[model samples]
Target: MSKKQEPGAAGRATIRDVASAAKTGKTSVSRYLNGEKHLLSDDLKERIGRAISLLDYQPSQMARSLKSGQTRLVGLILADITNPYSVEVMRGVEAACRQEGLTLLVCNTNNELDQEKHYLQLLSSYRVDGIVVNAVGMREAAISTLQQANLPMVLIDRKVADFACDVIALNNVEATQMMTDHLLQNGFEALLFVTEPATVNTRLDRLRTFLQRMQQSPQCIAEQGEIELSNSQGLETLLRDFVARHPDKHKAVMCVNGALTLQVARAMRRLDMTWGPDIGLSGFDELVWADLAGVGITTFKQPTYDMGVAAIGQLVMRIQGNTEPVKDIEFSGELIARASTAAR
Candidate 1:
């Protein structure tokens, strides 16, 4: 009778365990595991295959990765997974990874600086082949550590202040220009660019570009208002104040992002302001609730998912040793017109 070996006390099967169960040496079992079964006799191959099924063996990815010098794993760090924009981008990144036969490990930092730093270090320790970042930015110490790891990285939407890695973001200047023009063309002479604060790169870019674009029309009123990201305490007062100050200027509010858009919309609802008739509204990013709002909201739809896929594409090139200069890629936005921005 042939001897059948059981797994050790660790509750796991090792190559040696499979070998013993197959009535063969570890070398034959290893050869079978590494796709060298043709070197062994048909009887040996059958025995090894039977033993593997009975043992329910799974190889250690870490061990194989150490031997091959490539993990075939990618890391994606997101600032806030709950954001609609982040969710769309994640789907794109994940889909591209699957097509490339690579596994993705996602880390959401919840817009926390310390958490972002922690994930940056954690992903590096995992020996991920590449990383995709979509956070406020990176710290100097964390940046140096990643550089030392020699890991390829790509940024989505947000630029690290000092590090010039490959970037996949929207063309803020052009997109802002487009939105401003659309509002002007629709007869909204008083435009107030609304945002959380001009702190992050994306917000600053849009706010600056909107100011510059609005300057061309010397007679029109161009201004900006800031609101706290998480607070809605005085938002209604802010929106109504903008409209009240410009009672005769055909006023409107152009939010710089989706979150701001939602906030402004809710504020409008609270003030009993019918967007199209009372105050014109135009902004960036698509929202599902926009269509159901009083006279659907007009928004500039960003190609967020495509940007996500492009981020991974750039990272893969670096992983393959492109060795070229860092890349800065931007995508244009599509204007999704609705009743909210109609001529009044």
Candidate 2:
């Protein structure tokens, strides 16, 4: 007699539970569940049916779609889920997926190239209809492999080296230039651009743009530095040193992103430095806490939600067999001036 495993928590019954109840291997259960009952004996079919009834097991749409050859699932890979930028983009992606009646599977790589590769493989195994990726931008080989596999993919904010795809991102050059021009228009004589490692394409673009713009405008002295979030003391030391070097001049810090902006704000607080009059501050992102940071940190607000929606929309077009040329879609970031960059 086959053991009957009962379903728990209503929809909590897994394929493993069904197989166990039917006293069969997972492969056999999968074959039957995918509507290949003709391949199985009547006895096996009756047993599987009885098991499903007893357990009240319902197969997932993805499982059912395996037989239909279209899972209607999209994979979204984020470099770091903790970043507010990623969260905002995800909200838009989720909304678009819901409207399209598709499911989304999200993977957070924590900005690791290896993790990005791993998630790429994982998503591929699930036979996702398409993929939206905000990558760490180092996994060129993996990205190329996926591209070669003919999977529909959209790059968000970050572009992989040598792997051409539809990229939906901010206009890094224009936005960074705008921020730099705004800072120069103010009375700040010196600028310190602080950022994470310029590893990703977007970061690289912004850094390069800032440098180019500053070079064109000799009115301000500009310097770029990289910082890691893991070391607060190092950031503080860097901030202290930069401030100490510009004692007589009015200087401001230009953070690369919201994470760096938070770190700089904290470092300023630790050093008892005030924004405006003495020092000015501005960054790339306008986070939820941006206004709360001292006299409010100045920022360039990226259209993250729209970018997300655009990425998914492009991916869907690709999934539907659109063979048009891949073109990058860029959005502009708005500069929001605040007391952080106010003149003395």
Please provide, for model 2 over 216-309, each residue's C-alpha lDDT reduced to its tens digit, 9 standing for 90 to 100.
Answer: 8686788888989778999999888888888888899999999988888888888898877568999998888888877788999999998888
lDDT of 1 by residue, 1-344 (tens): 24445776798999888888889998998788777888999999998888888888887888778877989899999988988999999999999999887999999999888888888889889889999999755777767777887799999998887887998999999999888898888888899999887767999999999999999987899988889866776787788788888887888889988988988888888788888988888788999888888889999999999998999899999999999999789999898888888986
**What TM-score would you give candidate 1 relative to the actual structure?**
0.88
Clashing residue pairs for model 2: none
Flag regions of model 1 displaced more than 4 Å: 1-11, 16-54
Alpha carbon lDDT of residue 130, candidate 2? 90
TM-scores, each model vs. reference: 0.88, 0.81
Where is the poorest 10-residue window by lDDT in model 1? Answer: 1-10
